[model samples]
Target: MSDSEPRMIEILRILSQQEKPIGSKLIADELNEKGFNLGERAVRYHMQILDEKGYTERKGYSGRVITELGRDKLEKGLIYDQVDFIYSKFEEMIYLTDFNYITQRGNVVVNTSTIYNEESINILKSIIESGLSVSPYVNINEDKSKGKIEVTTLCGTTIDGILLNEGIPAQPQYGGLLRIEDYKPIRFEELISYKKTSLTPLDAFSSPNRTSVMDVVTSGDGLIPANFRLIPGIGREKTIEIIKKLDKIGIGGIIAISDEGKDILGITVPKGMVGISIVGGITPFRAIQEQGQEIDIKIAEEIRDFNTLSPITSTIKYGLKPVEHTPQPKISFLLSKSWNLIQQVNFDIEKRKGDIISNVSYLKKEDLDKTLGIMEETYNSNPKYINPYYKIVNHPSDDNMVGIATICSLSIDGLLINNGIMSNPKYGGLLELTEPPLFIELISYNGSTVDPHKIFIAKNMTSISGNFGPNKILASFKEIPYIAREYAVDLLDTLDKIGFSIYKIGKPREVTYNAKAENYNFGVVAGSGLNSIAAVRERGVDIHVKAIEQLMPFENMDRL
Candidate 1:
């Protein structure tokens, strides 16, 4: 049980005694008089915790009343119910103790709190965004810490009344939070340029599909087929399945930006949802009708058809409310003082990229494993990273495949990184990335190159490959160079920051100029030099800045 466990249970019992909804302030006064000596903060905390799970029935900004569940728990503990640990993080908790003494100064009595979850307590807030309710949890046979029962709500908990795949329940997953590096990131070229035909909407909607809303949205073509409100408690997979069906029927490619501005997709794909309402009629339950006034489905469909900012489904109710915002008060599960363990990556590597020749496994952390006993999900492996060498010039076969490992920067959401450090290999291998910007330097007299630097003091001249100004005489910034003077302007000027820098040498001499704009398709004048990009007639040049960024290791050389 949490340190506040006993007090919380006591608060719930008191609130349940109230016949009508009681204000947070009143609860504080009641607790105070009982010699229990709790503040309004504790009063509100108890109510919030209880109400979130349908235990207490919280009336709007008014007060709270004991709900059936609240009465049940108040009379008989929820001994057999299992809480679906839908949310994974614990650090983001915002603890607020019942402390309302200051509010009584003027008698209005505003309540204050004192909670001790993780700092920055990032509570994974979930609410009903909108849509029909479905099974929101996977219901495994796992039981977490029992020292303190973890009570949770599984009702119509949606993000903003807008349910995606029903509801993204708060189940913690082992190796979840995807360390980004796990999935293969296909480039625009790779994703689009494939020989595989673009699957038609019907073809893309596989019977056994497993993708996200956006994926289905992207594959869709015309308008949403139906407008309906979803009930809470549905799972995300079901929502995705619904989207897949819409895609099959043909949906307009999501307005990369527009939803409320279009027909049949108003306020869709919300960045953040407080709650959701739909225009259509209340989803007729299997056995009974719903409580709220039945909404106008025809109006909603019209709004959707007209592409109004308000989707038809939203006309169903007032803006949706948060799940935790519910009122009521009874709890048996205490979010234990400590959380059940999930998994961890313990690093054993020292900083510094010793030597490339030496076989060194860049990562120095032990591999993580499954924690199904604790967290609810599994982590997908296969970290992706960038391989700059794969795309180097003169290495035509290189693909410049991207590679990098993905890992979460957060520990437990409720617990926070209070006791650990988040580490990544790239940051750990900083020294190797900029070893003085690698390049080859030339010796003046010997004409031999060692250090990655150059002093281009051509005694004669130089010739550049690739095309020139319609075969026109090569002219300097001021005059044509018939007898080019050998001056080391910058040898590795061809390379950019990714490599060495350019330098000059001693004495002035003339040399045949034969330099080529290695990767410039936009046409090169004076400063234009070879780049990481190999000029070709295939695809035209890209954004100028991007081309240059690809080239590095600019060096300088001097001749004898």
Candidate 2:
């Protein structure tokens, strides 16, 4: 219900209430009357942008009228505003009230201001017992002072937009604070690789039976699918079924990033929705659909074929009025407050990893289950029932064997960490993945001994190279072995000779180098001895035998 963007809504609303085309001056005046204080010039500027954007129209110099796109924008704004209002009221109630005692799952505890009348308490009790969520609450302490009350609720009244499933609603909402007790996290070094095959919309429609606009755009190779469901006329029941099926296959919950280009939720899977079916050629029910324009399958397919950035491209080609930008909004059952729970859960998970060794192996399901059950019983018996965290891992023996590692952990932020679970006492405990930079370091060392700090030093070298150049330009730099400094210079010099471009070089002592012509640029730092060379490699510096030979001129000579 939050208007992530609000100004656009305000502009649309002003145009909606007017019958005839109104000039920007009048709109500005109306907004000023409503406390916006926008000058006519600024309003006119926004009006022109909106008109060009297709949200409004300039009719014969009369001014601007709300286009169908503008109306759609306004309608969505109202819905978000209403939802925000409800959530704000709920927050306000929690902030102001205090409860003397609060009970959850029959565990009663005292709080600051639990003085609500018996009837009010009972009303809440009924709602909770009926498997429905309640607004935020307050707790009063024994001293009649307020106590801490943490209230949470899921964002929906239904499961997959259905009030009932099999004649019963999904009560005891599944979207509450992720119970850390529910899942187990298995750790496997193999799962750490990012080569796993995952499903996408293209995969969904590439089969012989499916006909998606994505198929048309990429000649059945499948273009990036749009999240909007513009197909039209999809029945509620069918949508519900689709949602459940998608959930089972783990294809749902992907969110497109916001305009700010930050992924706050961390789930970065992209999704393309199979939009509403355009059956019977009736007007589409979606807000983005034009109010009176009849749409057939062809028009719907054309619209679906366009990507998010070019939403109106096909429509313009067809001489249709542009629709509002209608990318699918992120829909989540969990509320924002779950973020706090996620932080706590992640902390706990890190803490639990302290002494437990991770195992990576393919074991018979029964044997693996027995070992994990024993481990859980020994380590996590206090929490009688917890959720299992599925950690998918690649098998060491078989690249084709992908195993799910099940361990216990909390899933507050709607993501599951892959952990490998199979442990064999005979196979010498479990395998765990090292830190990301450490893994990169291992590769650079080429199975040779390298200090972990080499990776950090290498990354730091890259950072320094970005702003600082060779030693002459820097006023001061750390002093390291002279050989280490020479190694960096020789590496840069050799790279330039052997098809690599060297753009900059730092002083001989604290050697810093930047490469430009490679597929990717790399930086080198030369302060520490072997560690410095190792660090540069970890930081992505590719070296050749010629560079190594030049850097270590005495390598072929025997030591006295």
Candidate 3:
């Protein structure tokens, strides 16, 4: 590939991300941000070449847009020159990992795989329990529309990252098929050097027909994906210490570490270096694939906060339970229900003299016992969900009824309004569990009739139980004037002390965790008041939720 071709490919990539045509100057600026030194003139020259090659088309003063042909070329072209791509990418990810074994609070690399059926989840659980993967912790995401579940596991490359942080340099040598006997790694049957291929070697070799990971699980003899790495002999003891520390924290994948100039699983180590053999993180997905489950796998994709991951055993114990399918309500019925809700809310607002209302939701008298148990279980499983300032209260109207009051997220808007700061509710979204969590799915307030958080809960799209940090939860995004920065910060601190979950507050005119603010405005992400209720729903309890139902005095609520 020519130097110009790479630049042209990048230009096409930039154009692909835009909905409208972008001029050469903007493209040049973006390229510079990506560490490319291309100027506007050079970008214009590349655009001209791209136009000649039918890859891009000029859009009348708006600049150039990538054509269908360009997208196809970008997807299919320039493979031969990428032989060292995987090696470089692996190295980059290793260096990016900043997970500290002590605090367990930094980022670690992860591999994501998708399975279409619920039965496949059991296979994954078994693999995690059997210690065939990198770590006991995993992240799960559910897509009800597509009928698929995405599972994220710690990548073996994270070992390199941990070692790198400890002042040790580790080199990835090969990804291969390791033979296992009596559940012990014995040898590498086949190897693909990182320097020899553009594709990830483990990904290349993860075929249902080639690996019998499930058989190994049941019979203790089969071939599974593994990798080889090398580190200086001097760091061997330190590496062992790190491994033990990781084990204490429920993370492991290093199968064996060899001494100086020693061979591991028949792979010879270089002089002054020691060999390390690690089980592939994708082994569980490989097992699923061997069981005739269709899966899409991406190897060592990106770094995620270690705190966001939870022990796989926790998932097996509290993971999503299969629920019986119920017939969908007719559109007319839904519309009628929505209309009734709107009228009820209006009536309640009038009674409260336009004050923001906090909804009081009720649990069925019969379900009170089971539902409360689920809530307690959730709080025990992850202490982050514990809110000592909040608790269930007796129903106002009926002696036998039970009620729970959740502060409306809209109350934040009201608070800002009282302070002379205008606030606009923007979206209700599912925020991904990351260090600085971002919204993975969103429903705009302007486009929806029902509360988006309610919709997400009803659709069973939340995974709050498996891992507290990495699971998606209901959150709302609101925009406030940038000038209210100091005031808003003070208000948020007050809200926190009063028990509101404030996710983040953004800088002026910038996107906050994937939610964009309007000009001269900034964004704020607050936890949906219904998160605890959602947790109950996740545990298979059916509860009726009335959002922003009625206003109640804060002093009237009880503490848990």
Candidate 4:
């Protein structure tokens, strides 16, 4: 046989016989026992080869860890010359969202702004020095009472979220109590708290170090709330196995690797339906450690299985995407926005008989093979449905990415599949929702006989949930009421001429909203839904929106 047996296979066979991956010197001594006369160089060569093949994936540049293939080959005396092994690559770091880079390392700081001062900078430095991770952030909001927070980023800074590199309770949600928003040049005051991890890739060859607080926290039952799926051991195949289990369960996933006796091929997983989660925040966060950075990977207490429904439930929260949301007759400012998002069913088809759907016909693997065999006859035989999503890029000038429009798609069950945005770690699944072009209706109310000279004006557009009251509909233009109304009418006419179709007639819905000229403004509203018209339940998000606007000339809006 060609001495081409995989270096990993040979190393593993040696370890299986000897029970571990050993140093080159020891491996040489052992090979001598087998009458192989393999010198130190030979052993080193094998190690190098194994590492290159990723059978022994390395971390922090030099520390190598064995993979699933290595473990299997070790146990089975995998033939070096011809045996084939499967290889897997770790997911990108941005996708590693389940845990962040914080722990009991006291220096952890969560904030709405940037880190400032010597002490704060020290914490950030410690994070990098700790070797595993250190963090500085912008726009991270937290509300401890209800367990919710919104994280935001202004400059598109990509940093890992809170990490618990130690003992953790099962399925913890770390974000409920804290929220982060993103903005420019962070000021330390906005910083909230963050969970700090103990391990750093810096100076790994040196003796492992620990922080005083980190020791206690990692060793104690410190709360680290993040929803995660755990696999018991390390290896490429086993790593994939656990992920497959989670996939079958239906919830979207992110992955984290637990270091064990052998491997380095750790993968990262982020929260939500896809890896592309992004937030444009108004605040940033602060760092935790001041100095002497060290990663604390101490396991806390053992977690007990609390929720028995792990097997019964398949998703994070039981939410489903509708193939289409019924359109409400858009009359108010808020309703109009929702109407714009509402898509109508255009494909005409009758329900297929359950008889055909039920088919009850058995399909053998052979049948599939035959069907595919026929398609295989063509040059491009593979069905197009299985094709992966192609990513799209855009110019940096887009605001909230509103400058351009992207195609959004969805699965039959309503989960977002893809749309116009690039489907990377931060933009996955979100493809289903798009902010359609802003459309407005202007009615020139030249004061009726019963009422004063009240001119029905328009302006200040916002999200679909914004309202129809004065504050939201652009009252500033009242001084230029004619200009505003004409502008709106012109825009509508332009849209109509450009081929936009109205699915429903208009109606006037009296919406109570704050007003400038008067304490309140009541107005008529008209809008359309996706395929038809429908209404959404009114909530706080409504008044806030109708009350303000952005992008075009409008008022700044938020809930009162």
Candidate 5:
């Protein structure tokens, strides 16, 4: 294949995206915009050759359109001639990325995945919330009649673009599956060098049978798609600084940076070069595929204004609402409302539980204020391990006393129940501090009228005071029907985004973090909502404690 054939192929690609015939001048302009240095005369020469070969046909004087053969050729052209095709496209997108970290403006390259169903959208959002994607921001387009949804996500090459804009000469090396254990990247499980492949390596590795991104999202142990890049040793510090800035603006995917002359994840680095591992942008779609959903993906498909993308949380909060001028199907509209109703019912159940607990247990206003302060301090000290939702209400009996409501582990049970999964509260226990943690003491929630966390706290069974010796924290155990594992994992991920401290969701009929499940049920371990109050009590504050407290609006809760 001649050099001009590649240019003609590009022209065919441009024509494929157009709905009508386009002239050579317009094709030349588009080519130039994409960094191809073709002029009208040169493009006309390519088009004449394309027509002679029957790959494209001239439609009267209007212009030319790609033939059926042209579309096939575009997809299945000579492999040897396109040796570094993906590499070149990667470079082009990097040059095109203009996202300014400081001003938070300009265009960024994005990858789009089109799926045929709505269920996959939720799975994609959960993956984004798990932080496996290049950025948390995403753009979604839904067409219910066609049963299609297009998800546009930030591509990892955008980092390369930013690095280039900052005068750092970074070279993409390979795309691979990065092994993660306990949520830390350990090594590259498989790698394909960019110079050796015409196809996008990450995309080739994105099959459901190949990648374990969903496992990583749920258990923090599995392989995730990632990329390797290298920069000059002198630019190490500057690269790190830029990455920090990107993180501040919610675009995070830089896994690790190697020291000068050092290799990353056992891959050799050339002398005077530094390696950087980045999470691949195709992760969410990879996760969608893992759940047995089919998707058509395009890598580095186009550039869009950064302002047009919204955080993935928005999609989770608001389901596929109709885009402007696009009518939402009646069934789709009903499904969206049903999802919202499920969330509302779950919250209402918890709120009712809290109201019941509040009726019997009331704290003096002074005590309530102090308890809130203590809970805030505990959360501030370690927000990751603590629950952040609470409610304070006027006492029904005494004006001087107030009602304080905190999230209960039973809320997890309620969430599972609302989603059509039967959940049984097994035990409330003292989880001994360890790598995976262990339940040292347990009380049966079915037999006990009082919440077990409250019982354990009153009996001085918990030692979660100063993070010293024999440390134990509050946790609860529940079991869900074994068949509900997949649905439950997705639900737990959604709950995780909304401030639920879910510790571990177990495999079928197995022990999760040392707590066994029933024969046909899977175990779930969650942080007790009363853990903070336990800390307050440990501090010797005079506080009335109620576990499984009724529901409070999550948005109304204050953060420390």
Candidate 6:
């Protein structure tokens, strides 16, 4: 039968389904309901043609009914649709079962490049529908001249397990799907440059290679942290899954993902919320690593579970091990500058202070000595606070010095002196509760009024349990005063005449990130590395630096 005969056969099927003879109008209505959309006049014309062709016969006063010939034609049409569907399914099966290149023993060689285009994505969808785990990245060389795709599985046996289950004749050889080919190696620096130019937030976030060390220290042994919901995962679907889980638990907080998929830092749970931090960044991990600090097994475990809520209780249950932390050279310089600025500014302000914060008792030599002594004891005891990873130096000479120095600088600059930790003895009493006086508190105090902004303290500060003064607001590490990029640069410049570049600051510029699938094509431009970029922009410095800033504070902020 001709291709057009199939349309006529569809009409015959409608006639046979009816209990009695059907008119052309009724036949047309049925065809419309079935998506044929033929007009009654046209159906009537077709019925005459069917009669002449001997597939249909006219009944007494009734329009037409399917004869034996028509019934045969209708059956054939149904089989045709079924065969067409089976053909597509077979195509998918062939793609999944057969490999373009296989190992010597016929082990499947899965080319990651096969999954990037439209045709390949359809095959990938079929594979996923069979409940296979798919990784977001394929390690292919950046150079397009060599047509090779790198295959990476979450773990070994992922491919073999799937292939064996499908009864395919394939065996796992090496960890990767492909054997070594004549491919050019892409250097780390080149990759970074390529990513800087091309990678988007979504691409970076969804990339299988994107690995983040989540710090649950922010949220410990509590309900799922609110911040966890805000960070985006590999793609929209995965991100939606995270949002659904967080919403199911019934907590709300901001979680912004970075363009590079590196940093997911923000306040997840609000202040006073007793939840672990699901929001995290790897900057600190990288920072410490850059300084030759190896990630302890415990730290690595924490990183693995950071995105999920499983190990949160354990995080709170056990105290962290003491890891030696020395800031990077530039960071060290900034820390020294932060300390010197405080001392220099404080000395200059102490001499010309006519009238300062009302009822505020500035640190006397004895008080400074007493504060430093307390800090030294705390630092020696708690290694967590001893080597400030990303914040101010906790050394005896630098403890409480950055705050004091910032206050002095601001005071000398003629900014209004606010109620800082050093400005009031009660604040000192409040800070004294924390094991290490590594904490900084900044309260707003203009001539006759107090600023409505709550006093800023770290989320983990021991002083928050009704011990600190009333109206104290505990904030996350990112909310620290000097952690702001502009403020940090100012602080850095104040202490050291020689300037340093801030790598982790600024928003991510334009870039491309793609993840394509059937009925799905995600391309992020301005959206690339948003979470990572945001982490840098929002959190200011890197993790170690921000970690230090968490216990750090601002002085004379109103003046500055």
Per-candidate Cα lDDT values, in order, are 0.22, 0.27, 0.72, 0.23, 0.72, 0.27
Question: Candidate 2: lDDT of 479?
Answer: 19
User: What lDDT tens digits, residue by residue, belong to model 5 across residues 1-560?
Assistant: 24575687789889998999999889999999877899999999889988998999999999999999888777645333343566787887888888899999999989998998878988887877766778879889998888898889998888999999999988998777777777767777666566634446675465446678888866777888888999999999999899989977878777778878866675677899998888888888888887888899787888889998988773221111111222222111111222333344344332423211111235677776677787787777666567877767777778888766666666667567766887777766677766667665554454332455665676556665574433678887788888888888888877776667788888875556656676888888888877777787787876677654344555455454
Query: Which 10 consecutive residues of model 4 have the lowest summed lDDT?
Result: 423-432
Query: Residues 465-535, candidate 2, lDDT per residue (tens digit)?
Result: 12221111100011123334454455335533421222334443221221011112222321211221222
Task: Give the RMSD in angstroms, all C-alphas superposed, for model 3.
Answer: 23.1
- The regions of model 3 sitting more than 4 angstroms off are 10-36, 51-71, 314-560
Where is model 4 more than 4 Å wrong at Cα?
1-119, 122-171, 174-403, 411-560
| 1-560: candidate 6 lDDT, tens digit per residue | 24445467678877876778889888888878656878988888788889998899999787788899877655433332322323232223333332211221222212222112233333322222221222221222233454322222121112322233334322211010101011211101100100111111111122122221122223211111111221122233443343344333321121222332332121122222211112112222221222333221111010011111111111111112221122212112122223333333222222332321111112334344443343334324432212111112333453433222211112212111122212110011011222212112221111101111111111122221122221212211111122233443343333222111111112122111111111111111110001111122222221211111111232322210
Give the per-residue Cα lDDT of candidate 5 at 269. 73
Please give the lDDT score for candidate 2. Answer: 0.27
lDDT of 6 at 252: 15
C-alpha positional error of residue 207 in candidate 4 after TM-score superposition, expressed in Å: 32
Candidate 3 has its poorest 10 consecutive residues by lDDT at 316-325
lDDT of 6 at 353: 29
lDDT of 1 by residue, 1-560 (tens): 24454455556666765667778788788767645677788777777887788877768877987777766554323110101100100101101111111231111101111122222111201111222212112111112342211112111111112222223322211100000011211101000000111111111111111112122122321111111122233343454444344333221111111222121112122233211221112111100111121111110000011111112122112121222222213111111111121122221122211111100011111211111111111101100111112111222232432211111111111111112321110000000111221111111111111100101111101121123201111111111121221211221132112221111111222111211111211111121121111121111222111111121111211100
TM-score of each: 0.16, 0.21, 0.52, 0.19, 0.53, 0.18
Please give the distance, in angstroms, between residue 139's alpha carbon in candidate 2 and its true position after superposition: 45
For residues 1-560, what per-residue lDDT tens digits would candidate 4 score against the true structure?
12545344555655644433457777677667644667887877777877776566545543345777777545333211211121000111212223322221222222122222334433433322321121222233445664444332211111222222232212221111111112111111111011110111110111211112222122321111111122233233443443344334322223133333221111122332111111111111222321232222111111111121112111122111111122222112222322222222121112211100000011223333332332122203211111111111232453322111111211100111111111110000000011221112121111111000011111112222223211111111111122233343443344233222211111122111111111122121111111000011122111100111111100111100
| Arranged by TM-score, best first | 5, 3, 2, 4, 6, 1
Q: Quick one: how many clashes does candidate 5 have? A: 4
Model 1 superposed RMSD (Cα): 29.1
Model 3 quality (TM-score):
0.52
Candidate 5 stretches greater than 4 Å from native: 1-4, 17-20, 26-45, 314-560
Question: Could you tell me the lDDT of residue 60 within candidate 5?
Answer: 100
Superposed on all Cα atoms, the candidates' RMSDs to the truth, in angstroms, are 29.1, 26.9, 23.1, 27.6, 24.4, 27.4
